[model samples]
Target chain A: MLCLIAWVVFGILGLFSVKYRVLAKESFDCVFRRITFKKCNSNLDERIKSKLTGNLMKFSPKMARGVYRHYEFLSWIFVALFVVSLVLGAQGAYNLAMYDNCAGPNADPDQCIFTPDYDVVDCDDPLCDDGHCEECGDDCDCEECS
Target chain B: MMNVEKIRKDFPIFEKKKFIYFDNACMPLRPKVVIDKINEYYTEYPACAGRSYHDFGTRLTDEVANARDLVKKFIGAKKAKEIIFTKNATESINLVANSFKFNSVLTSDREHNSNLLPWQKFDHDVVKSKKDFSFDLESFSDKVKNFDIVSMVHTSNLEGYSLPVKEIIKIAHEQGAKVLLDGAQSVPHKEINVRKLDVDFLAFSGHKMLGPNGVGVLYGKEELLDGMKPFILGGETVSDSTYDSYKLEELPHKFEAGLQNYPGILGLGSAAKYLMKIGRNNIEKHENMLKSKIDIEGVEKIGHVGESGIFNFNIPGKGAHEVAMMLSASKNIMIRSGAHCMHSWFNSRNLEGSARASFYLYNTLEEIDTFVEELEKIKKL
Candidate 1:
């Protein structure tokens, strides 16, 4: 389960750096073995677990013990969070493409980064400049007055 | 008493790397002297031995012969011709396996893959170890009569326990069986005299004993070696050859096939000299003292933590590799994990593997404390 997440993370990092490529390949092998219902021969997950636990042991033994004991449960939680984020990201991408708003058509455009800012002024006012009045129509909801 | 601190100075790796190295059973760190000797061969005389008459070649040939003589003295062999250099202990064993005339062969259940794999083609029998993981002499005595040769590991790399080879050899000899002891683990740590042991054949590697890799020694009795055929036939192996008829070289040269590893041989000779200067008995005592200091609770020991330098164990609920990796991560403590190349023994005992911390003369009490302290933290986890 950790290998799946590691593969995605390392696979991306592997494109930029040469160091992570071997680890990326190892994690991919682990994930492939797991999917095929075979044990991971690479022991990449064990290396990661031991390294993490060992680093944690230096600062807090109790916390390290807890993490070591509940590693499987924590892996499941991490996998769940990763899957949820991936789904949410896909949904946001789809919304931005379909409705031109990552927050959806019913949601506020201010919440979406893709939403362009609009400059508007009331043309009914007497103080309205000529440049502003020309761009502003009867309803006056213009993006650029000039 | 061995001056371990002073001894540590001889190995150059300590100056560069800051780590507690406890993987000596697999390969001991080479001293500067051994390294220099290897470098000397390349810088001074980088030529084929025995074939050339130039100054470089003459010097190399002499050096190679000197290395063989040193190995012969190291193992207490009667003649230098008895010493045959091979790639490693595995090749040495395979050489004997291929050349020796034997209908059946017997080995202990805890044989390493090197000792076990070569005999798989022959009619092989295994004498099982006792429940306590000790070599079973009674069972071996019973099985000795049925086999033509009795091959066994002199000291187990798995747990560092030595078999009663003196007794085992006597029993096998009485049954008219030849004995070949794999001394890879034993020869490095303790003093082994082939003549005193009266063993027919002995095989050991150079890298495991502070020597360079790609060189190992096989010591066989002169009479026995004379009877066996050459394991490999090549340029150096033949003294004269016709189109259809060829006369083989004598003794050691007959077995050494191609252009030999001259640098490795010189390094191994230097290693032998270094060990002799330090004294093997002092080394054994130092290792015993170091092993005695290791005391960690709440762990399942693989075998009895005997007087040998190796300490193999498994922290409860943790894999062997996990414990080893944790120790490495915590303090850069190097150790060995897995079956230690004795998979058949582990499989028979229903164990995955063990974490092994093998000490040598360079290892100290402080390193043992660090190892124990890290193991304590791991046990808690």
Candidate 2:
């Protein structure tokens, strides 16, 4: 607690220092601030963009042809990852939302809904094993002998 | 042009399924006349080609030789003796490659494997292709002097690229070299003047040009064929035989050494007649017109290798095998996928290879519309 208080006091004193005041003035001033940030924006990576373009330009027609190809490659990777994540997240959320009600006696508001007859999906083709789908073993494996 | 609807009737596949078969690079489904010829040979007088004493066999032999004459005329050869029969274009090429005495050979990666592989793995000194998959006339000419044979495909199977055959032939002759062309893709779709091209040899398949399977043609300069020894030796190829020594048959027969499929020969002969009647110039225009519109954008990552009516494109996420299964099941459209027995070339290009849709003469515009629609649907998936 004391260390936190001390640190806050030191920060306050630093803010009031001569060098600090000039810095604040410089940042708040619109024109100078604009010049500094636009030239050195941390969020927008101008260097990486330039580097990418340079590499892209150096490529001969053949090399330029190759790869994911042009900017479409980057887009494809992004799209693939985005699609995979969205699907996985949706599946996870759905599983969580239905977990308890999936086998609960009071199916209302349960995480998962249970069928009394357990005949919803037929898994009898080896995957279901002897016509059972809902009755799982001690290891939580499904048995399809119904 | 030429009342395509009326022409399409001659090819029975259009009657069965209204499809535009742009995949002629793969193979052409036989026409009714060719198919009927095959059926007649089988039912009426099915006999081995080239040799016989009986009436049916002699008729069959005469028909087979007549087929050779038809092919020679079709390609504008000096003599029918220049033509050699084989199973297909692939075997015809293999025969030439195996027999041709070469210190070195020059071709390009632009070639289908039939033309390229003959020399790439050949125990010869030098086998060279273009740095990229494009053709270079100057490079080819400069190198021709050093190489013994300059074997190249007349038009690339991938791009439908037509090479400067006449110029290349002249260059090869100047260098005292021989040239062979793979016309398997070009012959069925385009008109070729082999005499004008002056190439030493040409090979093409029957199946790709609206004929039956188990039939192909290899056209060599008469002198060259007479000098070179035959590859396969069996019962029919021999002129006379003794226990110790046997003299081989001359010209086309020397190259063909077995009991031939006379049905297949007559079918191919009819196919040649079909081309002659249709006029190759009109067919080239019609097929190219379809090719010009095919949407190759779906496979832009691999891109269309060439828009020469053999549309080759590779999908990024889909391997050709999986894509082929999906296409077969989801859409009634059929396409040939995988490396096409050219794994080495595909591997060198850092690709698993591509799916191909090759087009031919009988294929209609409506079929292309269906193909494009299916391709668009496939892209969405």
Best by TM-score: 1
Residue B233 lDDT (model 2): 87
Local accuracy of candidate 1 as per-residue lDDT tens digits, B215-252: 99999999999998986899899999999988999988
Q: Which residue pairs come into collision in candidate 1?
A: none
Interface RMSD of 1: 0.8
lDDT for each residue of candidate 2 in B1-381, tens digit (9 for 90 to 100): 666778877877777874345456777777799999999998988876556679888888788878888888889898988988899888888898887766677775556767766676763432344554456778777777877887877876665667778888898899998888889878887888788888888999998888998899998889888888877888777899999999988787888877776788899999998898888888888777777777557574333244466666766665565445434443445677777655656777788777777666666677778777655544544
- Where in model 2 is the C-alpha error above 4 Å? A1-146, B18-20, B120-133, B295-298, B301-307
Best by lDDT: 1
Q: What interface RMSD do all candidates show, one decimal each?
A: 0.8, 16.4
Model 2, residue B8: distance off in Å is: 2.1
Q: How does model 1 score by TM-score?
A: 0.90
Give the TM-score of chain A, superposed on the true chain A, for all candidates in the order listed: 0.77, 0.25
**Interface DockQ of each model:** 0.63, 0.01
